[model samples]
Target: MPIVQCVPNFSEGRDLEKIEKIVQPLRCKEGVKLLNYEGDKNYNRLVVTVIGEPKKVKDAVLESIGVAAELIDMNNHKGQHPRFGATDVCPFIPIKDMTMDDAINLARELGKEVSERYGIPVFLYENAATKPERENLATVRKGEYEGLDEKFSDSNWAPDFGEAKKHSTAGAIAIGARRPLIAYNINLDTKNIEIASKIAKTIRHSSGGYRFIKAGAVEVSERNMTQVTMNLTDYTKTSMYRAFEAVKMEARRYGVNVMGSEIVGICPMEALIDVSAYYLGLENFDLSNVLETNLME
Candidate 1:
């Protein structure tokens, strides 16, 4: 069976009951395996990682989206993460015996189905984007939920699937195919969001920072700390250690200490290995050195 990984980010992270309800469909699905899931109260977002046959994975994702739409109301939703829908962004990643094209096709199929069935506008992003501009998710979600209404008025901003108008409570969804990405966040000790924002701007791609990094500053109100949340688009180009160091180096200038770091959902083991090798100063350390790597073989 051809395997594909789907990470669907839903907008209700604070409510455990609703989050469980949203992910209930993925639990007993025959062909799908729920690898992991995490809810961040700070961002008010839920990140779920699952892998299975392409069609089965798509089916599971669609079911979860429906549940998310029914449970989460974006109209009253508030969080540190930028989102425009109940099921904010869903990305499909090809894993075993699958190609990028196969993932793209699955994304399109899921997008069409979700749009037709739920009446929510769907935008194809990343590799599945229809236009060059839409290729970047940040660009596709430029206006966020608040500006979604006016965004639909522009011809250039019309959705790739379903009506251009936004869903009353569920809002809109972005579905696409892309390579594996790491959702890493670095927390700072000080409660000043400005320091976090500055560090984010210095390390993110849009601000002429790293090549494959998209970053933003978020306030974790409950903890009274700030975070530099990031999406490492291609870890091969810009490793996790480099991003972490960049924030650490920048934080020093603001006299802020590094609180800790977090990985939102499942990440490739190689990414962690690379970080370990760098921090440990181990020469030529690779997956071959990992005991689990040999066991898998």
Candidate 2:
């Protein structure tokens, strides 16, 4: 009866046939619901969201990771997103009747199985990280795929599971347990990636921005625009509207227009409610005011 959500990011996005094949295991599986899966051609990445009974969800994700390992070749991979493996990063979050400890155990279980079965090295990150330095995903992915060999050479950079070496075609993966975070992106109506990058640096934590924000810039080539992509690690502390408004304020300095914004995967309803209250200038607004919130109960 324990519920958990798993979001597995794969390195392939352009090829629809392969994308479907990779996610086939999660589709129509008992005790598991495939909430959403999005493929971004520009980033060349697929983000899949699924929530279900903990064990069933784990099995489905493991099967899909195997499919990704066989189908995706990291040597021929290229994208604006930083990645080091076929199944780049997989994080498990406790949903219902579950605790963080349960999620961490599930992450360790999957990490070990994937490493032994597919020969892919795994790094436990975030709450499941063995070392303080490995807790931040950015630090874990610093060198990326190209620098994997050099990274493996250092004793301090050894993986949590499997050999110290990276897989030839599949590379390596980061499996972790963490609190839910929103992956949001704001688009700017300009092909100038520098402007987007500047805005990203201004609002990201690493550059003295918001404490719970991790951000970067990427080009949305097909749309002829640039995007300020971000992960709002704690919405309660740093809210979505605050990040959106900050980006708008910075973009105005460069005379750039806000194209729009998007949430990459599923997000808490409270996050959207906060945004609505801010934009509508509502007084003392909360989830209780929403009709659907009451109906669900």
Candidate 3:
């Protein structure tokens, strides 16, 4: 059996009821397993992890996106995260016995379905991008939700599927295939967002920082603090510990304390093992040493 993982991000995270409703399709479904879900109130987003057969996973994702489109009103939505639709970005990762090409095909299938059924413009990104410019998700979502109308008006920014105009309330969505990405955040003790933003700029790749890091700052209002939120695009190239240490060192310059850190949604155990080995100064740590790794094998 082939396995594909779908991590769909929705724009509504503050309301538990709405979040549950959006994820209902993945629960009790045949050939699909709901691995995990994490919601952040400050960012007003939900990240769901599900894996199963390619067709099953694809079906569940499309159903969930439909629920999200109906329940979420992007026009009135506000959060620290950059989003353009109810179901902001959906990425399919090839897991067991699946290749990158397989994931891209799944993405295109879902994109076509969502566009035709719901009238939501879908932009295929990452490995499934139709053009080189759309390969980067950030570039596809450059203007965010508020700027979608203007973005679509320009011929250069037309979506791969559906009409050029944005959905009335659901807005637009970005669907694609990509390697595993870690959504990591380092919280700062201070409430100043500027300090967090400055540190983010120093460590993100777009600003000439780490090669595989995409970072920004967000205000966690409930916690009354700011965080350097990041997406470790390729953890193998730029591990979590490296980003953590960089943020820690930068925060010290502004007299800010490193409160703590969090990993949103599911991450590969190897990513954590790498961080553990670095922090523990392990000379020869390997997966063979992990009990669970052996058990699985």
lDDT (tens digit, per residue) of candidate 2 on 98-141: 99999999999999999999999999999999999999998898
Expressed as tens digits, the lDDT of each residue in 115-201 for candidate 3 is 999999999999999999999998999889999999999999989999999999999999999999999999999999999999999
The segments of candidate 1 whose C-alpha lies over 4 angstroms from its true place after superposition are 294-297
Evaluated with lDDT, which candidate comes out highest? 2
Tell me the TM-score of each prediction against the true structure. 0.96, 0.98, 0.97
Q: Rank candidates, TM-score, best first.
A: 2, 3, 1
Angstrom error at residue 21, model 1: 0.8
List the pairs of residues colliding in candidate 1.
Answer: none
**In order, how many clashes per candidate?**
0, 0, 0
Task: Write model 1 residue lDDT over 1-297, tens digit each, in one string.
Answer: 799999999998889999999899999888999999889887789999999988998998999999999998898998878899999999999988899999999999999999999999999999999999999998888879998999999998888899999999999999999999999999999889988999999999899899999999988887898999999999988999999999999999989988789998888999999998899999977899899999965
Instruction: List ranges where model 3 is wrong by over 4 Å.
Output: none
